[model samples]
Target chain A: MTKTKKIPVSLTLASNRDKSDHLAGFLSISPWLIGFILLILGPMLASLYLSFTDYNLLSSPSWVGLANYRSLLTDARFLKSLEVTFTFVFVSVPLKLIFALALAMLFNTGRKGSSFFSAVYYIPSIIGGSVAIAVVWKQLFGRQGAVTQILSLLNITDANLIGNPDTALSVLILLVIWQFGSPMIIFLAGLRQIPIELYEAASVDGASKWRQFFNITLPMLTPVIFFNLVMQTIQGFMTFTQAYLITGGGPLDETLFYAVYLYETAFEYLRMGYASAMAWVLLIIIAVITLIFFLTSKYWVFYQSEGGR
Target chain B: MHSNKRLLSDMIFYVFVIAIGIVMIYPILWMIASSLKPATEIFNNAVSLWPSAFVWENYPSGWAGFGGIGFATYFRNSVMITSIVVVGTLLTGSIVAYGFARLEFKMKNILFACLMATIMLPIQITLIPQYIIFNEIGWVNTFYPLLLPGLMGGQPFFIFLLIQFIRGIPRELDEAAIVDGCSKLGIYWRIILPLLKPALVTVALFCFMWTWDDFLAPLIYLNDASLHTVTIALRNFMDTQGSTSWGPLLAMSSLSLLPQLLIFAFFQKHLVQGIATTGLK
Candidate 1:
């Protein structure tokens, strides 16, 4: 009841509360904080250091300056992997996004079994990265496999698609494109968020269905398209299991993914330092691409809150 | 006339959807069917969906595995690692999410941004160094490399997801609990956690699916044949058997995917909804 005395007491109490909140916040997040330092941040710095050294697993790291990086520029497998990964990312991401967007549009028509169809489509995205799927893909495109048998009927004899350098990467791309369900689902969700009134308004203005799609739907869906593109591109670059298992980067290292090459360098050959350098280069590549995406997003990606660009 | 046009369009839509669905699902079905076909029948009748005779022997034979180990060991390893990883993800993810969502602290926004940035960070950068650290400590060829990261924070994506879910819960609930002298931990436990069921479920399913399907980590960490996971074992099976035993190979492949298929079947809604909300893996 005494105003001056109560004010002083309340100020101390508020400060006490703030102190507890700080302690509690830190305590609760300690697991992640500790992990971020030890697992991610520390390892990141260590890898950067290791990149300059010539350490195998057994030896002490001996610094070789930029030799490892310089060697990477001339490393044929490294260049081949860059080419393979770039091709995969450029080809598969767009094709996957196109298929996803098309299927998403098809399902968004409010047909009765659309959900069931979507669920069925999603099954592959769940298991597509597994060894089992890779094995299935190999067999499906192998010399004696079903695809060859079908193609042979059309005079495409002995067409071992997976064993051919020219078609091997495409086979992996097809497998990846087959698992377009996740992005399709994301697209479907984005489509649902587009208000029905926009289409209605477009129709009232005598806009054709194609016009409605271009003016109303596509402009609205650009954000989702951008999200899918960035994620799928990143994922496409890291694709290892399919190329590793299906082609073994084979016939001429045609399907050698960057991650697969890095794995072989580090674990298989025990070139820890060299692999570390490759990892850093990969990180830089991913960072640059993601930065480019974010920088470009402003021009194309429309946020409803921004009322269009 | 209008009704007829609508009916024809509907029919065409159904046919297109169903046809594409079949094409999409064919490889999976083929694998399942091949598992039951005889070795000769597997390739000779590759185009056929129906097996002339169901060779139930493939399952038992594939289960026998190689190097004196069995599919049973691989499966047990997978289940153990996946379950522990899922539980760890849920616990750490929810706790960290609570901190970010409810409590005001120094550098909170910066830390949250750090967490989000990690969601896009490629694993390759950390792979070699983490392996070095584990190898230095003689933790290589053990589950520590695979398990510790999950136990620590699971994934930044999971934490980000739970944080989004936690923010949606009314702050009044936390405040009322505070008035009752409930501690911050108590509010996280009694108020936030119970309300976090759906999001936790989404996290758990994803964690389980990803961990189970994960090949690279197990491939790097668990080298001993006895310590191999289902994915690694399947790869080994393919390597050793090559083309001699397609039936048993396909059998094991199908068996390996059974858990994922079952999870997807039962929790389709949760999985779809999780992707819709987070737009993440």
Candidate 2:
């Protein structure tokens, strides 16, 4: 913290010259400051403005106020994608939390090789969102895949799992669920932070393992649970890769997620304006959901310590 | 509580947990085993726990340039992009995270909020616009677009995470440095950067894996086969019609996963910390 250029903390309040010095003090943080202006802040505001325009890259964006929004409200594909995305988040997020929580509880036994188990479980989470893993999933469930070949053992010759509309979405869901390692690992960490003596005391009080889990672990883990739920929910809503690479959002759009459809609309069809509008709506939806979660957090989220609960 | 019932419940829990683990790992294990098996042996053999032949030559065949060109060059591209992204993300993201975490500034809170806000915006809306922007800049087929975004706070999540970690460090340290006539830059360089090693390592490792595994960005930007990342290379191992020599593709994919594995193997604890502290716990 040695100064080549120092802003004196005791600068006189009576001088306009000190303000210029403070400005210089601010100028030192130019990397993030300039980046925010040039990249993120600028693009975000532009995206908002772009949402109301008819800019399709070839022509100048003419202001068409609220037209994009109006059309999107009735756009069937957009609505379908909304439903698909909602279904995805609605199903996957809760299941993810539950599975992750369960896995964490099991691993929290402080077993030997626990670290290795944790790492192994986390490996899928690392690559799960990528298109490569999704592609591997596509191949695994393809007609000539391991799953299909396994099914052929039962003489079910026509079990094309990835192609079937009924099963395709579920496959993606399973993929999402399989990557429970992120939350599971986080939950394990949270569980470790919880004092083990509480569980030991509960056992001494003759409480069963399930009772101890319900009575002790659940309440203690709520804050971590809440955080994971919000993050995973947002991530689940924005899922694109699995459906994109696997089903291509096909077999009658069963797997056509909001982001995938938005990507298809924007990139495949050059509907940047419509896509921008969709992006805004998505932003609003996510904002509202986050706001709701934050608002309700006071009611349920428990922070443990000498601090508070 | 009934002791017998409790015992039965624990037994059931263990059963349930083990069952779930098998199902969870089965597909990935299947991929590994299949990649080792010969082409004819893939389906002819039952989908069991392990592969029989363990033909390691699939790695070389797969790495050898496909269509008279192979994954050798593609692996290089993947390496290049991943390395660039790693450096870019650490350099830019740490600087920005440092700004938000330690440095006081004008509208600092507002700008940090804006960074968080970008987290939820779908990348699709930007893809075509960014693509056209890149096209106009004559960078559509170049690695610039693929690599440069990482240099910005394009990845806000890691920045936010580092900010949280930075906030955990005592400000008194910086104040002490100030008393010793240290500059703010000196505070960041000596006090903050060294202390922020765990978070920085977490950020760098995740960036490496993320950029390496990212098919979409490279898929969109690097259209030239010569410039293809591993993901695109794996895709090219197949055709539009589906089902041709995927064994080698899967084998090469197994190879592609090596970087991530190496990352995890070396930095397991930091990675665990990352998973735990990636703004959740």
Give the candidate number with the greatest lDDT. 1
| Runs off by more than 4 Å, candidate 2 | A1-28, A152-158, A196-211, A304-309, B1-19, B49-52, B125-128, B170-176, B179-181, B240-242, B279-281
Candidate 1: misplaced stretches above 4 Å?
A: A1-6
Say which docking band candidate 2 falls in: acceptable
- Residues B214-269 of candidate 1: C-alpha lDDT, one tens digit per residue: 99999888889989999999998999896798899999999989999999989999
Native-to-model Cα distance after best TM-score fit, residue A112 in candidate 2, in Å: 3.2
Which ten-residue region of model 1 chain B has the weakest summed lDDT?
Answer: B272-281
Q: Write the per-residue lDDT of candidate 1 for residues A3-119, one digit (tens) a residue.
A: 566777798998899998999999899999999999999999999999999998776999999999999999999999999899999999999999999999999999898999999
Give the lowest summed-lDDT range of ten residues in model 2 chain B. B238-247
lDDT of prediction 2: 0.76
Give per-residue CA lDDT, model 2, range B38-81, as digits (tens). Answer: 77776567366467768876678777857666777888888888
Q: After superposition, how far is residue B25 of candidate 2 from its true place, in Å?
A: 3.1
Clashes of 1: 0
* Model 2 lDDT, residue A29, Cα: 42
Q: What's the TM-score of chain A alone for every prediction?
A: 0.96, 0.88
**Per-model TM against the reference:** 0.98, 0.88
